[model samples]
Target: MKAVVNERYGPPDILDIREIATPEPKAGEILIKVHATTVGRTDACALRAHPFFVRPYTGLLRPKRTVLGLDFAGTVKAVGTDVMKFAQGDRVFGLTPGGYGAHAEYVCLPADGTVSAMPSGKRFHEVVVCEGAWYADTYLKKFNLESGHRILIYGASGAIGTSALQLSKIYGAEVTAVVSTSHLDLARRLGADRVVDYTDEDFTKISESFDFVLDAVGKTSFFRCRPLLKPEGVFAATDLGPWWQNVILAIWSSLTGTGRVVFPTPRSNRSFIEFLSARIELGEFRAVIDRKYPLRDIADAYRYVETEQKAGIVVIEVVPEDVC
Candidate 1:
């Protein structure tokens, strides 16, 4: 097997593809020969161990798990003795949130972990964004979004933003997405009722109000968007603001009962993935991939994602020939 091993927490160059032992399934686990994976903010964050929180569990000075990747779509090559639900040749796609090891030819995960059968019709690049979408879905659900609700989503081009935009539309919310000029059309294509080019206009300066404001990329704060939120509206984010500012905002909102700030705890399970898979099959959701890279160019993929210019997911196509 070949994998991009990460031994330290630093630049994307810290990861390099090398021959490594293929993982074997433990009891209740499945060994998947990954055909496609994604290198995005999740992989980038875990690789660099930013925000200083990933250090405790991953490793203080270095990473405990050398392999780095998150969302994966692959085929099951083998299953552990206790895993009866899946068999060899079954197509699967899900998140390895427990351990970052999806950037490789093969990965082993517990059958019951955020794993599910891959939905048909969609390409690997599209399905590979499911994990991030799952997280985005979870955060929005906390607000119990309903039809006719007016909402604003900032950074509406990344995985979480894209997912949030589509899901919000499905729930009947009138979504106004804020993105750069380059991504204005992308947001509209994803079903945003309205799109704002942040490059040309300052969204915060506008007089329009929304029932909720979600900073999908954690690029803005409550203070900047407070005017946009209805009095009882909520301001939530996928990424925590600098120095725990979002956390402080959440607490402040709780006490004031004015503009509430929400930070939903992400929950990913097999059941969630199963539900999302069904949606993908129905053409209700899709992932916009900006680029594709072979396993050998994984470092470059990471660099590209770090640029924050990607419109959606950055897929890493892992054919067995190139990996093995």
Candidate 2:
């Protein structure tokens, strides 16, 4: 099997294509013939080991996992003896933790882990974004978003941002999205009730306030968007927080008034996957594909995502010959 292997973390260039033996499913895992996968911002972050804070878990000096990819959409080539839910040819999509080998032609994951059957009539790219969207949904649910609520999504053009926008709308919140000029149309198409071009205008300068303000890109600080929140509104950012920071924020928010600053940490689960599948099948959500790269071209895909100009998901077509 051909795989994109990374011996160390630095830049996209560190990734190299190499031939490796195919993996077999473990007792509780299933081996997937990857048809498609995505190179998301998280993948890039893990690649560069940026922020220097995540290194403790990702790796001390180098990445623990040689292959780097988080989300995958593929068909089951083989299943472990204990896995009765998935047969040999079920189409599925989901997230993997340290087992980030989706960039390869095949990946093995626990059948019960974040993995789920691809909803009928749903495409691979559409489900590729489900894991990230599940995270966004989890965080928004934490903030108690409800119908008739007004919410603002910063960085609405990125994968997480776009997913947040669509999920918020489906949850019945009136959404206002902030994006770059090039992504205005993309944001609008994602169902944002209103779009703000952050390049031309500062969202903070606007008079409107929201029940929830989510900074998908982590570019805006909680303080910067405080005024945009309603009296009891909540503000959330996707940037990973230190363990102590998460504890402090949780404690502070419990005793504070008017607003709270929160860092969202999404836990992947089956229910979330089921929800995403239903929405995608109903056409309530859509995945945006900025570009598709071959397995060996994973490096170039990472470069494109790091630019922060990508409209949506950047998929890596593992089986390019099978892609339509």
Candidate 3:
């Protein structure tokens, strides 16, 4: 099997595609011939070990796992002993949250982990979307977002941002998406009740207030968005803000019982994958893909995503759709 290997953390240039031995499923696991995957913010962060704090979990001296991809969409090649939920040739899409080896042509995941069957009528490349939606779900879960409640999503054009905007609508929240001028129409098309062009005008100056103000791209801070929140409204961010203020504020908020600032840590689990699968099968949710690259050109894909300008998921087709 060929895989994207990054022995040490650095830039996209550090990545190399090398032939590696295929993995076999362990007890209660499934071996997948990965057909498609993605390069997103999480992959970028893990690749570079950004923020300097994730080192302990990823690796203090070096990357714990060289194959760095979180999302995988493929077909089951084999199942381990006692695995009954999946069979050979079953199309699937899910996250490799624990070991982070989805970049390979073949990878193994626990049968009861984040893995799930592909939504009906969806292609392998189309469903390599769990990473973004999984992170977006953290906010919706934290806020306990409800129908009729209003929510605002900042940086509404990126993978996490796009998914957050769409999921908020599915959860019955009236959503206001804040994006640059170029993504205005994209935001509105994703079901944002209102779209704010941050380049043309200041989103903070808008007259609307929200039950939840989420920084999906980690480019904004809570203090800057505080005024837009209702008295009891919550402010959440996907990243630790500048100087790690979001984490600090989250602890303070939790200790003081203010419930003001929250730092959501994305969890990968089968329950969430199932949740997304249902919505996708119902045709109420979809992943926003910006572009795709062949497995051989994944280094270019990483370069593109690191530019920080991609509007949505950057897909890597490990196995061409025609072949799949």
Candidate 4:
């Protein structure tokens, strides 16, 4: 099998296309012939080893796992002896450990790890690349949004933001999406009740309070948006928290806060995948794709995503090709 291997962490240029041995399923794993996968912000972050903290898990000096990719959509070519839920021909999509090796023609994953049947009426590429969206949807569910509740989604045009907007509406919140001028139409189509062009206006200056304010891009800090929240409203961002930060925030919020700050860490699970699948089948959610690249063009795909201008998910399609 041919895979894109990153020997060290740096720019997208460090990733190289090379012929590698195909992976086999372990006792509790399944071997998939990867047809499609996605390049997300997280993947780019891992590549550049940004924020410095992630380096310990990814690698201090170089990546521990040479192959990089997190989400996958592919057909089961084989299953380990311990696996009984799927057969050789089943189509599935899910997340993998160590940002599983989905950037290749073949990858292996645990049988019970974030794997699920692809949603009906959706393409493999679309379903497989939606793991990030599904994860975001799960987090939004924790808020239990209700009708008439005003909610704001910042970075509403990215994969997680787009999913958050649609899921918030489905959960009955009156959605307000904050996006760049070019992506206003895209956010509106995803069911935002009101769209704010962040490039032209500052949303915090508007005279309105929201029950929930989600910064999907992690670009905004809690202090900057605290004034925009209602007394009981919640402000959420994707910034990973240190243990101390979590504890301190919890204590401080209990002491003197009307509004609270939250850092949501996305988790992958089968139920969340199933929930997202049901929504997709019901036509309540749709995958937003920015572009698709062949496996050899993985580096180029990373470049496109790093620009921060991509409106949604960027995918890599892995197929059997004779090129070295």
Candidate 5:
């Protein structure tokens, strides 16, 4: 099996595709012939070892998990003896969380982990995009967004941002999406009620207040965006920006019970993927793909995602499967 191996933590150039031995399923695991996967900011961050704190988890010196990918959709070629929840030949779409081996043509995940049946009638490539939406869906669920709520999503054109914008609309929230000038239309198309160009205007300078503020890119802190939030509104981030300040603030808010800073960490699983798949199957959700690259060009895909301009998910086609 050929896989993109992260030999060390540095530039995308350090990643290499090599003919590695295929993995076999352990007890209570399933071996998948991965057909499709995605490259996003998470992959880039893990690769670059940004924020520095991740080093202990990813690697102290070098990457512990050499293969770099999180989202994958593929067919089950084999299952371990103790696995009863899934069988061979079941098509699935799932996430690795921090396992980080989805870039390969084959991967082994616990049978009861994030693995789930792929939504019927969806293509491999298209269904794989749902894996990128896991975090957004998790956060929205935590916030319990509902009708009449308003959310200001900064960096609304990226993977998590795109998913957050659409989910906000699905929950009937009035969404204000902030993005670069090039992504204004894309933000609107994703169901943002309004769009702001970050380069031209400061999002925090606006008069409008939101029921919640989500800094999807982690570029800004709760202190920076708090003024834009309603008196009791929530502020959240996907990334732990700048010296773990957000993490610190989130802790303080939890302790004081007087603030609304939250960083949600929902476990990804079969049920979670099924929820996202149900939305896609109903045409209520769709993956906003920015570009597609062949398995051989995965480094380039990482290069593109690292540029920080992608409007949605950047996919890597591993098995040439058509997706919807």
Candidate 6:
């Protein structure tokens, strides 16, 4: 199996594709021959180990997991003992949040983990989405988002942002998507009740208030969008914010019982994967693909994702779709 190997924490240039031994599944695990994967903000953050806080999970001085891919879509090559849910040749797509290795031709994950069967009639590339939706759903779940509630999604063009927008709609929330000019139409097409072009005007200055305000791309802060939030409204950020203020504010909110700022730490599980798979089958949610790269050119993919300009997911073809 060929995998993207990054032994150190640095730029995308540090990543190299190397031939590595394919993993065999352990009991209660499944071995997947990865056909497609993605390089998104999570992969970029893990690759560089940025923000100085991801160190504890990735590694203190270096990356513990050499292959950085969070989302994977592939076919089950083999199943280990007691894994009755999946069989060889079953198409599967899910996440590898526990120990990411999906940037390769093969990955092994617990059978009962975030792994799930591919939605009926869906291709590997089409369903190669989990990390972004998982994070977005986590934040929404933390906010306890409900129908008829109004919400604003900042940075609505990125992977997490796009997912948040679509999921918010599914929860019956009236969504306002904030993005630059290039993504204005895309946001509206994804079911945003209203689209705000941040370049043309300030979204924070808009007249409407929201039950929730989400910084999906981590580029904004609670203070910057506080006025948009109604009283008792919640502000959630995907990033720690500039100078780690989101985390600090989250702690303060928890201690003070204000419930103002929330920095959700996403937990990967099969339930959400199952939910997303069903949505895909129902044509209720769709991945927003920006670019596709072969496995060998993953370093370039990393560079693109790091730019923070990608419209949505940057896919990696570990195994070509034709082959799959």
Across 1-324, the per-residue lDDT of candidate 3 in tens digits comes to 899999999998989999988998899999999999999888888899986888999999899989988899898999999999999999898998564998999999889988899998998888888888888888889999999999999999998899999899998999999999999999988999999988898899899889999998888899899999999999999888778899999999999999898886776678888888889989888888899999989989989998989997999999987887
For residue 299, what is the lDDT in candidate 1?
A: 89
Model 6, range 239-316, lDDT digits (tens) per residue?
877778999999999999999999878876789999999999999999999999988888899889888899879999
Per-prediction TM-score to the true structure, in the order listed: 0.94, 0.93, 0.98, 0.91, 0.92, 0.97
Best by lDDT: 6
The lDDT of each candidate is: 0.85, 0.84, 0.90, 0.80, 0.85, 0.90
- What shift in Å separates residue 174 of candidate 2 from its native position after superposition? 0.7
Q: What are the per-model numbers of colliding residue pairs? A: 0, 0, 0, 0, 0, 0
lDDT of 2 by residue, 72-151 (tens): 98899999989989999899988875638888889998888888899898767667886558768877888888899999
RMSD of each: 2.1, 2.3, 1.1, 3.2, 2.1, 1.1
lDDT of 2 at 162: 88
Q: What TM-score does model 3 achieve against the real structure?
A: 0.98
The sequence of per-residue lDDT tens digits that candidate 1 reaches over residues 163-280 is 9998888788999999999898899899998899999999998878988899988889988998998877888987778889888877786788654888778766678788889888
The alpha-carbon deviation from the true structure for residue 41 of candidate 5, after best TM-score superposition, in angstroms, is 2.0
Candidate 2, superposed: residue stretches over 4 Å from native: 240-251, 254-259, 321-324
- Once superposed on the true structure, which residue ranges of model 5 sit more than 4 Å away at CA? 322-324
Q: How well is each residue in 90-176 modelled by candidate 5, as lDDT tens digits?
A: 889888756589999999989888877887877887776654477887778777889999999998988889989988888899999
Error of 2 at 123 (Å): 2.8
Task: Locate the minimum summed-lDDT window of 10 residues in model 5.
Answer: 125-134
